[model samples]
Target: MGIILMFMLLASVTPFLFLQLKKTVFALVQTILLVGMWLYFFEVVFQAAPAAFSIPWIMFYASLFVAEVGWVMFIIRLIKTSSTVQESFQ
Candidate 1:
């Protein structure tokens, strides 16, 4: 439970860091963290007792979904922004 909460907190900050940080290494670290969080949540979902309707379980899945969406948006924005920069340079 503590670990899950910790991951939730970290996951919450990851998108902002991924989008705002200018450093490539920082973006890479955040991407790794995002993937790790998804895998950790996947394990929790599979190994936990059957309680799909429970409040905590629901929240966990909800957060996982939000994190995944954020990751996709981050990728799209990164590509769009990079392409615009390249176009401007050209």
Candidate 2:
């Protein structure tokens, strides 16, 4: 009980703080990822909602791993959008 509450609080608060500091696309993505990951943890321990062998269940589990992919894609996109030199020709 206590452990679940502690994790829940941490999961919700950290992303909220980031969003407060920076209301941007990255902040929104982070909020979704963190909350989704928290839901995954809750389901893992409590067996709530979706059954063990279902797509939603798999998605809940996937949230645990998607953080890396999200960040990597964000970084790659950021690089792609950045200018190569000090100024643009167009």
Candidate 3:
């Protein structure tokens, strides 16, 4: 329960946390939604406990997958915009 709540909070806040990357907000939100849904499925559908679960791999893969996708999209958008701005100066 608590674990799920914490993840939910993180999902909600992650987008705002990276406000510097305005274009990334959408990607961050998508990732958050995916994470949140997966967590809910595990907690509700599978009824997993928040005990000392020794599943580091699950956490690592899930978190990194979402974050990696978001980061890649963010970098792409940032580069595209910066290039456009540079081109405008010429």
Candidate 4:
């Protein structure tokens, strides 16, 4: 659970880094981290935690979902900006 949370925190920051770097590689890595962390939480933490932890679990999942959506939007914007820059250079 601690490891999952740590990774989640790390994953949250990566999208901002991706936006600043504007590299496809960073975007790819961010995508992988986002998906992987969620899978880890669902597969590992969800299964291990007892019923008493339900509320915290829900909160964590909701936060992660929100972060994921934000990152996806940022990635889309980054791609659009990159394309615009490329078109201008041409």
Candidate 5:
């Protein structure tokens, strides 16, 4: 139940995150991965993927990879865009 909800949340939020980093090479790669992630999600959900594929394990790992990469990039961009720097400790 909770896992399904988290899946829905990630699907909802991914595109909005992409919009934050437009017109760059990293953004392009992120877009490709984003599309692939959702494509796999939909294919597996609809049972459109091939019969021999190990659906659950592959989807689990792919989901984690996509989520991690996306959020890490977002956080890095967030820090880069911050209005102030962290205080230096001498």
Candidate 6:
């Protein structure tokens, strides 16, 4: 689905973009919180659970959400390590 594709693209590129743009940790935290909240909102929106599609495409999107969480955590760790290394070299 188009939404899944877009999410995949975002999940793949956002961390690198954040690093390149030297975005603040606060921004990343805000993004993660916003996404988690949005997902929770949608789960509530579909309170009855999703309908059974012939091919269950939604599963991929759900998995992508999990992957994105990992990506966010990885980015946070990357930021911490970079900052520590920079401080050490200074």
Q: Which candidate number maximizes TM-score?
A: 1
Which of the two, 1 or 5, has more TM-score?
1
After the best TM-score superposition of candidate 4, give how far the Cα of residue 43 lies from its true spot, in angstroms: 18
lDDT (Cα, 0-100) at 62 in candidate 2: 50
lDDT of 4: 0.63
Give Cα distance to truth, residue 30, candidate 4, Å: 18
lDDT of 1 at 19: 58
Q: What is the per-residue lDDT of model 2 for residues 1-90, given as tens digits with 9 covering 90 to 100?
A: 686566445545544444544546655665666666666667667975666756545544454344444445555655666755324755
Instruction: Please provide TM-scores, in order, for all candidate models, with all chains considered together.
Output: 0.51, 0.38, 0.42, 0.49, 0.45, 0.42
lDDT, residue 83, candidate 4:
100
Find the 10 residues in a row with the least total lDDT in model 6: 52-61
Q: What count of clashes does model 5 give? A: 0
Q: Candidate 3: deviation at residue 79, Å?
A: 0.5
Clashing residue pairs in candidate 1 are none
lDDT of 6 by residue, 1-90 (tens): 467457655654554555554656634653564454445435545775445442233443444564576567667878999999999999
lDDT of 5 at 82: 68
Q: Report the candidate with higher lDDT, 4 versus 5.
A: 4
Q: Flag clash pairs in model 2.
A: none
**TM-score of candidate 6 to 2 decimals:** 0.42
Per-residue C-alpha lDDT of model 4 across residues 1-90, encoded as one tens digit per residue: 586577488667766666665666666655665664565467654576434346545545555665566567677887999999999999
List clash counts for every candidate, in order. 0, 0, 0, 0, 0, 0
Candidates ranked by lDDT, best first?
A: 4, 1, 5, 3, 6, 2
Give Cα-based local distance difference scores for all models. Answer: 0.63, 0.55, 0.57, 0.63, 0.59, 0.55
Evaluation by TM-score, superior candidate among 4 and 5: 4
